[model samples]
Structures are given as structure tokens and as C-alpha cells.
Target: MPVVKEAPLLDGSAGRLVRLYTVSGGRTRPTASLDLLTLVVATGSEPPPRSGPEHAQAMGLCRGPISVAEIAAHLGVPVTVAKIVLSDLVDCGAVAARPPDSFDHPTDRSLLEAVLDGLRRQL
Candidate 1:
């Protein structure tokens, strides 16, 4: 079960303010490109106490491969911010990330164009 707690009310602009403050704390983000679908697995047990709540939550969630988007959603943070945090964990060797299995590059553009043309004609 998710641990639910009542948070103190914040002013309307607190979200951005909080993100800016946390990100400015000077941890360098990892070089790995964290895509929405990239698979992440925990490489360590529970993160050390100083690693912060997000890192601990990520470690717990990543016992199996989980997507960056899901992690971000669970953490209630933006994907960009999550990537930065996850990257830090990766740098600490607490997690392993794998890019998506399918390549985005088109193998045959002419063949794709031909298929598109046929579909267009049918429409």
C-alpha cells in the first residue's frame, strides 16, 4: 500500500518553486538519456538515508524493470526532473537503465512512403 500523508497546504506557485529549489541543490544529473519507456531496475537495496525520499521510493519500485514515466508519476514530479534524480541514482550505481528494445530509425523510408501512399489512396 502507498503511504499516504496529508501535506501542508502550499501557495499556488509552490510546485515550480519546489522543483527549482531541489534541482539547485547541485547534484549533477547522469548522462544516460532517460526516455519515458526506458527500463530501470534497482541495482542496490534500499538507498542510504542521505539519498532522499525520491531515491528510496525509486529503489523500492525498481526491484523489477519499470518505466521512467511510471516512476515520475509515482513520485509526482515532472519527467525531466525525474530523469535528473534517476540519473543521480544511476551515477551512484543504485540502478540500471536500459533503452527501449525497438530502434526509432527507419530501416526503409521508401517502403514506408509506398505504404503511406497506398493508405492515402484508400482514404
Candidate 2:
């Protein structure tokens, strides 16, 4: 049930602080990241959960720009836990962010096959 706010003029990456303006002339700051990964992590609430050793350990476990959900999975904690950590990091500017140009995810093969099969059946 995500409210599509006319698809923000400036699309951004997860775990980074970004400034956005609403269609109604209101400025929106980085309250929190909200990608699919973020949505899973944040559990659809705020200010967010709490950060602890698990977050640090997640940084150690994963070398890349880690998201809340990824960190949670690595630490065997809930995504909620990881998201809190991410929110703290975002506030502190501790996490590095990949540019939007690199915003690419591998396609899910099973989903792709399902769609292809449906198309073939229709044809």
C-alpha cells in the first residue's frame, strides 16, 4: 500500500540521504530510505528501530554498501533491527551510498519464466 507521490522527480538509492520536493511545493528531506529493500527493512514505520552491535557486525560481514535488510539477514536479526541501524547511520552520515546510476538489480529468473510462460500460453 505504498502511496505513489507522482514518482518523485529525483529518484535516489537506498541508505543515502536525499532531498526531495513534493508536487505540492513542500520540501522533503531524507526521513529514511524507501526502496523495496528499505520498505522490508523499515517495516513501514519510523523513526526506525534501534541500532547495536549487530549493525557493526553487519558492516564487517558485508563489504559493499549494505542495506538494512541485508545487514539484518547477515546478523540473523530482524529487518526492523537493521533498518534502525541504517537510520542512525544515515543521520550520522556514516554509510557510503552508490550513485543512482548503479541502481540495478538482477532480474528474478523464476518470475521471468512465469511471465514468459503466461505470454506463451496466451499466444
Candidate 3:
């Protein structure tokens, strides 16, 4: 009888590295306009056929509105990778992306002082 040797399994970090690479398909840039604070929500439609697990996972997380950073944290991938996966979903209409609202003017000092005063009063 011939003895067979099984291939060594990847360690946790190595496995995650491979998963990230595979999830992003070795792409480093996202085609969509996505920032850390950009919010994403599922469109209540099924993912396109042959979509990767990352896409499905992203859609699941986006069942409620979620930030790109939050999706990255939940998927255990870098923000860039999360953006790529999200872009794919967006292209297929599985998710919708919304840019965060930006303040047009600098924060008011009075507002800052009021918040500080409120915190002090609470304490």
C-alpha cells in the first residue's frame, strides 16, 4: 500500500490573506466611488449569478444601512477590498451606495462648547 501525505492547511492569518486576495480577485482599486463613511443598503434583490461569497456577505450586512468601514470590519477585510466587493454588488444592482453627507461649514465653536457643557453636567 502506498502512503499518502495530505497537504498542510494554511494557518489562520495565511488563510485570511488568501481569502482577501481571492475575494478581491487580486484587484487593488474599486471602480465605484466609495469612502469609509459611505453608507450601503441592500436593494432587496438577489445577487447576480456566480457572485463570490464576499458579495453575498456584503449584501447580508447591508440588509440595513451600513458604512463601508463597518462592512470591512464585519468581513474581516481591508476597506479597499470591501470597496471592491461592494462595487461589484453595486454594478449588479444587489446593493445601493450613498455618499455620506458632508458639512459645508466648519463646526461651530458654540456647538462644541455646548456638547462639552452637557457632558460635564451629565458627569
Candidate 4:
């Protein structure tokens, strides 16, 4: 007969989490870690949101990796508006992009080079 022992537990304001470590082959490994991402949830009233034609169009354009300002110009909206829409999409997980860098419109040579490179890759 063998005795069964329980794992140690960690408690939080939201829930209790169990921490378990396993020993094997002279090595110790943590079997589990706290689900910190999903365990703490947000609860509060949110603002009423709106989307214009350009915003909807931008959402589609942003389905693939894209820069925020590029999508803004493509959809004919001001950069500020585009930024808000992009932020909302990111928070909602509808689109994905690197967070904006201090933006400058891509230069002519830069644009042409990127296009050529893309064409080369496809061929």
C-alpha cells in the first residue's frame, strides 16, 4: 500500500491554483503554472462603439499583417481615427499587427523595392 499526497496550492482573489512539480530521471520539472492570462477577468461597463465604412474596410485590409497608417490611407480615414479602430481590433483580436512605430510614409524607392522583393519571392 502507498500513501497519496496532495500538491501545494496558491490562492488569489479570483481563484485557487495548484502547483505541482514532478521528479524524474534526477530532474525536477514544474507540471503546471498559474493560468494568469485567463484567470483574471475584466468586468465593467464599456463605451458604445461605432464603425464607419472606412473602418469596416480597414478591418478587412488588416486581416493580414499590415501597418496601421497604411490601412488608414487605404481606407481614406484620418490617422487618428485609424489608430482608434486598430486599437479596438487588436483588443478584440480581429486583426494583428506590430504596434505602431513613429510612422513615416514609405518612400518611393522603399515601396518599389518591397514590391519587387515580393514579386521575386512569388516567382
Model 3 ranges with Cα > 4 A deviation: 1-14, 102-123
Question: Which stretches in model 1 have alpha-carbon errors above 4 Å?
Answer: 1-20, 23-30, 45-48, 104-123
Query: TM-score per candidate, in order?
Result: 0.63, 0.41, 0.71, 0.37
1-123: candidate 1 lDDT, tens digit per residue: 999984532357654334533742554454678889888999864555587666777788899999999999987777877787788778778899897665555358898899999999999
Ranking of predictions according to TM-score:
3, 1, 2, 4
lDDT order, best first, reads 3, 1, 2, 4
**Model 3 TM-score?**
0.71
Clashes of 1: 0
The residue pairs that clash in candidate 4, if any, are none
State each candidate's clash count. Answer: 0, 0, 0, 0
Q: Local distance difference test, per candidate?
A: 0.75, 0.46, 0.85, 0.45
Better-scoring candidate (TM-score), 1 or 4: 1
* Total residue pair clashes for candidate 3: 0
- What lDDT is obtained when candidate 4 is compared to the true structure? 0.45
Worst 10 residues of 4 by lDDT: 34-43
Model 2 C-alpha lDDT per residue in residues 1-123, reported as the tens digit of each score: 988653332335643122212111232333456342542222222232443444455446435544555666665544554555555555555554332333576668899899999999999
Task: Quote the positional error of residue 45 for candidate 3 in Å.
Answer: 1.8
